[model samples]
Target: MHRTRRLVPAIAAMVAGAVLAAGTVSACQADQKPEPEQSAAAPVVPAAPTPTPLPSAAPGTAGPDAERSAWLGEQLREIVDAQHFDDVVNAKTGKRPPAMPNVDVAVIELDDTGRPVAAANTLLTQKHPHGVAVPVTRDLSAPGVRWTHWSNSVWAAKKSTEPLLADRGDAPLEFMTPYPASVFKLIVAFGVARLADRGGVRYDEVYDYRPRKATCPDGRKPGKHSVSWWLDAMLTYSSNTATCALLMMLHERDGVAPMNGALRSLGLPTLRVVNTDPADGGGWSFWGLTMTALDTSRLLLLFTEAPGTLWRTPKGDPVTVGVLKRSSRATLRKMLRDQGLNQALSTANWCGQDYPAQGIPHAVPKRWIDPATGVVHVEDRTYRGDVRKCADDAEVEFAHKTGLVPSAGADAGIVTALPGAKPRRYVISVFSNLGCTYVDFVGAYDGACRYTEKLATLGAAVDALMTKTAGRATATLVSGG
Candidate 1:
């Protein structure tokens, strides 16, 4: 079914206002509480006792529940078949906007230890989706594995007549498409965290804001800040300047090599962090980084059990490693938990109208002063998008990242069903070339709002499936003697 979600203010307008109000803000910032300054990193905690090696269960006998896997697979298929990609037809243009023709989706159930549970009797090999399947592997032996591919011709039927900004012949395998700022921020966070864990960087260490070529999307340079401060800004506010500074730091310190190497060590080679500075032979303004939905999803699964979690090595052997120190992991999670932006996946309707707030810690009061006019607007959750508070409904927490550029929009995160509800945890990652930068209901049709609604629908459906099958046992096969 085509679900409709309330439309929030256009991001382009927000960017314009931010430029007038404060020149350093990016287009993706939303009204939320100010994050406290982190002059010092959180104290690191000692490693916990090593966990026992979890035996890989025979398909469907143990590990992640097979039923859940089957349910998720069906949901993905339905979404692809429903053709939500081109549901919105532009009234004036009389053409459907471009979207990610190849909509890739993956949902993996995680055990308490955070390793992917093997789903029994699940379809490991996907059939030809959208008439052609992109060249990618579905590693059943890898932690949390299930892959599905599909494309809607309607979305891919037409491309924007807009001239290409930069066309390097043929995108690389990891360069599915230049992901948006939000997704890039997530990758930068992982790289920085990995560096800190290896003692190559420190969270509290201050650095001068320097960039080879990258800066805020608005062309302003960011001020100097600590590694932890930049991380908080990048993840929480989607600050392009902060993202650029961190990326520059990574490049100067040769941090990208280690981050990509670490991902390969975990058996993910298609995911990579690139240098966006064009002067350095990278397109800092255009296509900076490349990532896949499945790889992105798997990376998020790691966060579910970071700081001493057992995972698979590149050789498929079991290994327990602390990807992030307990303090580091906790600090990052808190920043995401209090994320000011919730208009994308977190706006999905989990509980009904009674509890409007779909995500965690009821929507707080939102107040913003118009920098252009000096008029202060004070309303209860007024400017903070359409999501409202629901104290009674099941509280779900979405600690994830979202991306929005003129040509593409993406959202990926770990969805957790909090207390007072059946404990269900899963990771979902979605990416598309959909144009979600249009102003809502003005010169253009509400395609961006509709696209967000479609994502919310998927989020709601995933929550339902996970909740319904929570605690259900994996289907087991018995031999007839």
Candidate 2:
């Protein structure tokens, strides 16, 4: 749901030319009472400065790797130049020149053997009007990069809960929105999995959603449902209510004390849940959770390298930890791959899974149901569709998660080429607040769509760099095929 907050005066000036979209609340929070309206709009500040191009290889200098690196650098520069946020600003506000915000990019490439062969880290910068090139800061919390919330993946990986299948019986796993915990449901599902692991619950356990006495702070009654339904809704459809139910069940079974202990044992003591769904709370949205890009990248790496160590302790001891069982990891990866929303990372055209498929699989059909009366109001079962495509036509595979808030956008995951070729994989994480503007409604400016296109373009550029360099190098390094 849309919660209004005062905008920064400076951001207002920067985006004076932007056309604000009509304000709309989240459909997921329809059950909860509307929050008090906010009076002021917050300034939508840009994060980071324009990226500085990677240095080119001196003419006729060095070896083949150097030449490939130089060529890749040039390709990257072209990609960065194409994303000049100034162009967006200039188009919106013709009077004043736009300032260039930085784009934070991290690319790690693995060899045919799955070992890191090369890594590139750089910040692109644009020449200022005064002819000076300033570097953009890598602040994770900056308005430009703050929209990313990769912690959901970690929560899903570490959450332990009881299977709820027994209690659910033959009940259908379905419900109406806005379901709670859309993205946050991963945490709740983990809790349920843990419960099931300990013999405390079953996957069939059913929960009623009819309004009744409950623990929720919003005084809202639970929907007619069960744990299994909620878990599926949370991951596949991002149901808000289902997420709340899972969190509440986990806490009631045994406070977060057990969950926190599990985190400590996994070397993630800081990743803890502190609040219920923001849709049910009175505060800034997403303030209930905290995370950083670096931590997120490390978590994804752990998931990818499960049953293996991502790092070692300062004492030289290997910290081999697998957050989820191999089966669970596979399940989560499948869920991520089957994500209903494909705007950001999927736009890269590299998510080789069945992306061209139309409509979300588990999404609740559009209909009106009164929780109070248990009566049907309206029924629209037609599936909504997503038609965005990658700029390039090449098929690439990626298992990734994307995060979006009012002022930020982010994506992270593992990418690999099609089979047959030496299996090379890369872990790419991108966080950006460059063109994110505070709009009143969920469908605000077209800028977010443009930003997604930019991300897809960058993904393509990175794919080219890895394929051209490593593909050629490995071909030459290997013996006769």
Candidate 3:
């Protein structure tokens, strides 16, 4: 992956402005659970006066920044293969990789923000074994620049923290995607929240949201949901209905960036809704993208901040603690809180591939089941084929998302400690697409599993690879493009 991002200086500038969002959060304020803790992520790492520059920008067209980022990505690739983590599992059959693949597994380490931290050394992390992944033909346009991800700024998140924006570098890497509409959707949701803040409306008092529908005769007298709850459904739950509903609520509030309030307050250079589909695809996504692990990694880093960015007043001043009660970012983040946590996006029915009734041709191989009912709280069912059972025996806890289009497939998420992982924490994201027909269940799974499986194996490799690359540019990044 080769691309450039001017993160250091931008991140460095927001220090003094790092105020919390005001008192705009409506419900579940007290119920907010801390983000799942792994060895504290890179977010905790204070932004330096300037960020270190990335090496690569895009392939065949990098300047200094691009070269560095490319160098970094290449280095990590080498490390993944240094001990042959690539072969830790078969790229093709999902079988174990060759003994050679097992030879040089790369090291994955976490930055202060608990993000994957690796050495900026090496070309591609070399796999101890040969590259056996067969190339598949697929379509998708050439990589184009686009916003791939954005995070809502909340209260108490330090201003010195990184900016709430990131994107795939202009450089083209294999399978990198620009910011998808999901990023914008969330951004719009935040916009609506800001509008509410300005208008003095509260989420709990407006639209309501729930995973299970409320009972009502003819659905006439059922209890209602709040707008914030709907916003949560749009985000954490990725609910299509909630997303569309929330957009409608903010039609009068949003501006050029999608949702509402002054665009300058949110500080988002890119965060606009282009589609409102149940699948979160369509509209702006058609532009093209080239996303990378690093790009997504950056987004993960940004989301860990506080939620007060939505409390800003008309003057862009802080309205609450831990966030600026008066800024656009505060209002934006608080808007999400209006819906509170545990909405449809974060809470949904968990049906594994065995559900059988949906004929959905989907199977969940991973899940974070509820402790009370032992039911899956987060079911990862993107995998097609017979692999539906993958999650049944998993020792590690996994939170995953999978996507597929005719010639395209993708999966990304985090894999935390299972019973067997020595260190017990990993974050992985992968995407793949080809110019061919994905005829049935197998294709659907192919579209998704490849990304997930690669991420699963690769994330583990990152753990080991970075451990070996310390202070050494010659260290590996898992090899094989």
Per-candidate clashes, comma-separated: 7, 65, 141
Candidate 3 vs. true structure, TM-score: 0.41
Per-residue lDDT of 1-481 in model 1, one digit per residue for the tens? 1323333311111111100111111332222212111111100111122222333345423233343444445545554434344443332232333432334555665544444542211111113232122232224222322221111221244222111112323432212232333675777788888788888889999977754543335354647888888898778656666776777788778887888788767755546655455222123432235565666776665555522223445575543335666676676776666555454555432223321223222232122333453232333222322323333443566777776654345677776766676766667666755434322222332232223344454455555655555554332321111
- The runs of at least 3 residues in candidate 1 whose Cα sits more than 4 Å from the true structure, single-residue gaps closed, are 1-71, 90-94, 98-100, 118-181, 212-216, 278-282, 285-288, 306-311, 319-321, 348-394, 437-451, 473-481
Q: TM-score for every candidate vs. truth?
A: 0.66, 0.53, 0.41
Writing each residue's lDDT as its tens digit, candidate 3 over 170-208 gives 523212122232333444544554555566456566653
Judged by lDDT against the true structure, how good is candidate 2?
Answer: 0.38
Task: Assess the local accuracy of residue 296 in candidate 2 as a C-alpha lDDT between 0 and 100.
Answer: 43
Candidate 3's displacement at residue 238, Å, is 3.0
lDDT of each: 0.46, 0.38, 0.29
Give stretches of model 2 more than 4 Å off. 1-82, 85-105, 111-221, 224-228, 255-272, 277-286, 305-307, 313-317, 348-394, 420-423, 434-452, 469-481
Off by over 4 Å in 3: 1-72, 78-110, 113-201, 208-224, 255-272, 275-285, 288-296, 305-431, 434-452, 463-481
Give the C-alpha lDDT of model 3: 0.29
| Tens-place lDDT digits, model 2, residues 191-244 | 566566576665577755443333343455467566666666555444445556
Rank candidates, TM-score, best first: 1, 2, 3
Q: Please tell me which predicted candidate would have the highest lDDT against the true structure.
A: 1
